[model samples]
Target: MVEVDNATLIAFTVLALLAFVVALIFTGLSVAKKSKLFVNTIGEVSAKYETDITPATYAFGIWNLIFIWQAAWLLYAFGSIWRYADGGPVLMKPDILPIEFYLFWISCCLLYIGWLFLWDREYLFYAFIDLFLLTGCGYAAVAYQSIALNNNMIGLMSKSPVDVTLVYVLVQNGTDLFFSWTTVATLLNLASALANDPLLKRNLSAKSASTISLVILGIMVLSWSLIENTVWFDYFKYVYAWYAVLLWALIAVIVKNYDRTNYNSVFSIVLLCLVVIALVVKVAVYASRIS
Candidate 1:
C-alpha cells in the first residue's frame, strides 16, 4: 500500500475546508445579488433569455436540496479530517478525500463562483462556458468518488450500518446528485445562451433551438445511462438519486411547457419519457446481475 504522510493529508483537508467556505460565500452572494441586494436576481436575468425548454420557476427549488445534501457531505468529510488530525486511526488507506477529489471539488467550486458572476453580469455565452467547466469538474469529482466507493474505501471507514449509510447518502449519493443537477443546469445554460444570441435569434427560431438542444440533452442522458449500466454499474449499483433528480428536472420542463403550442414542449415530454424508460432498463439490468 502506498503510504500518505500526515502533513499532506492535513493540508488537503484545510484546502477543502477553505474552498468550501469560498463556495458558500459566493453562493450567498449570488443569492443576495438575485434578491436585488445589489443587482437583479439570476431568475430575472434568466427570464430575459427564456427558451422553450427552460424549466419552470419551481424547478429551481431543487437547489435547496442540492446545497443541503452537499453541505452534509462536506461536513462529514470535515469530521473525517478532524478525526485524522486528532490522532484517530486512519480509517482507510489513502484518505476519503483523495488528491483527485480535492482537485476536482476545488476546481468545481471556484469555477461555479466564476460562472455565477458571468451569469449575473449577463455574459450568457461566457457563463455557459464556465458552467460547462463546472459541470466537468463535478463529474470528475463524482467519478473519483465512485472509484473509491467501489474499492470499499468508504466502507472501510464505517463502524456501523448507520455509518455506512451516511457515507452512501452524504458522500456517494451527494456527489452524484450535485453532478446530475449541474448536468441539467449546463443544458439550461446552453439553451439560454443560444436563445439570447442576436445572431442566432435572427437565424433560428427559439423553438427550433430549444428542440435541438432538448434532443441533444436527451441523447447525452441516454448515452450516460448506457455507460452507467455497462461500465459503472458495479460502482453505482442501486444508486438512483441522480436519475431521480434528472427525472424531476425533466418533469419540471414538461410541467412548465405542457400546454405551450410548440413542438419543443412535446419534445420535452418525450425526453422525459425516454429518460424514464432508460432508468427502468438500468434498474432491471442491475437487478438481474444481483439475482
Candidate 2:
C-alpha cells in the first residue's frame, strides 16, 4: 500500500541490486581466501569439529545456479524500469513493486553480508542470530508476496496460478527459491556450529561429543517432523539438496576419520544411520514434489 513514484522506485531498485552485487563479492572473496592447505583460514576453523551436517565444499556450487537466476531477475527488473521512460504511466503495479518490498529486500541483502562476516570470523553464536534476522526478513518478503499475489497491481489477482505473468516467474518464484535454500542453509550452518564449536571440542570428553551430536540430531529431526505437518510442509522438499550434500560430507568423514585408533566406530555408525534415514526422507519428499 506504500506508493512509490517512478523515479524514486527506479533509484531504489538499482541501489538495492548494487548492494546485492557487493554482498556477493564479499562472499566470493571469503571463499577465495579460504586456506588452500587446511581451510582453517575461514571461520569454523577446525578439522576435529566438523560434523556430518556440514556439506562438502563442492556442494556450495549451487551458488552458480543462484547467481544466474538472480542475474536474470535483475535484468528483468531493469527492463520493467525502462517501460516507465516510454511514456508508460510509471508502469506502476505490483509487478514493478512498491517501496516496502525493496526495503525488506535490501535488509535481507545487508543482513546476508553481515552474516557472512560473522560466520567467517568464527562467531558462531552471533552468526546464528544473524541468520535468524536474514531468514526472518526473507520470510517477511514471502508473506508480502502472498498478499500481493492476488492484488490488482499484477492484476492476475485470484487467477495467479493459471495465468502467471513473467513478473510472477522472475520476481515471485525467484524469491521463493532463494528463501527455500536459505532456510535450509541456515539450519545446516547452525547444526554445524553446534557440533563443531572449538571451545566445546576442547573441553568435552569424547563420549560427550558423541552424546551432544546425537542430541542435536534428535532435536533437528523433531523440528523437521513438526514443520512437516504445518502449512510450511514444502520446506522439507526444499531441504532435500542440503541433506544430500550432508550425506556426502558424512561419508567423507567416515572414510577419513572413522577408525578404532582415533574414533568410536559404534558412534560413527549410529551417526551415519541417523543421517541416512533423514536423507532418505528428504529424497522421498523431493521426488514426490517432482511427481
Give the TM-score of each candidate: 0.88, 0.63
The TM-score leader among the candidates is 1
lDDT per residue for candidate 1 within 245-282, as digits (tens), equals 87898888888777657777777778888888888998
The best candidate in terms of lDDT: 1
Residues 1-291 of candidate 2: C-alpha lDDT, one tens digit per residue: 676667787887797689779877876776775534223334345333454444455555656666676667667666666554334423345444656667787888898878777776676657767887887887677556545544544344332333245555666667656665566566555655655556444444434444455456557655654465355543323334334434554564456455565444455556667767766765666567678
lDDT assessment of candidate 2? 0.59
Screening candidate 1 with a backbone cut-off below 3 angstroms (N, C-alpha, C), the clashing residue pairs are 34-41
Candidate 1, residue 192: how far the Cα is off, in Å: 1.2
